[model samples]
Target: MTEPATRVIVVTVFVIGALTGCSRRDRGQREVIQNKGSDTLVNVAQAWAEKYKEVDPTVAVAVTGGGSGTGISALL
Candidate 1:
């Protein structure tokens, strides 16, 4: 397959995996924002989460990073 096609497949798999994971979550009391992907973005995401928390204490933000594969598998 061509490179772009392969990338599209991978991204499609990732989005499907993410969506499936979302469906299984509980309807908890708190508002939650789940950000899981790319170890490289961990610090940046965390920083944003921290600031966001200060702005809105009622909402919850989760920032986790273990690598691209790890992030995707989290959706499983």
Candidate 2:
């Protein structure tokens, strides 16, 4: 496949893995996954969050865009 398609596939797989890993917890309580990153990825992140909901309705994915620096700082 083309480079762009490959990149998309890789990212999709990574996101799915992350969401699934985070979802593995108490099913009785609602869980929220915070995804914060580049502004350019805001739309893509939101799309992933929406799709992930179908996979696990008990978990809510919250996405916010504030650039790479801000995203990294949040990890600290």
Give me the candidate number with maximum lDDT.
Answer: 2
Using TM-score as the measure, the top candidate is 2
lDDT by residue (7-59, candidate 2, tens digit) is 99999999999888565556577888999879999999999999999999888
lDDT accuracy of residue 19 in candidate 2: 87
lDDT of each: 0.90, 0.91
What TM-score, over all chains together, does every model reach? 0.55, 0.63
User: Clash number for model 1?
Assistant: 0
Instruction: Give model 2's clash tally.
Output: 0
Clash pairs detected, candidate 1 = none
Tell me the tens digit of each residue's lDDT in model 1 across 1-76: 9999999999999999988857544555677899898899999999999999999987899999989998888789
Q: What is the lDDT of candidate 2?
A: 0.91
After superposing candidate 2, which stretches have Cα over 4 Å from the reference?
Answer: 1-27
Give me the runs in candidate 1 sitting further than 4 Å from their true place: 1-28
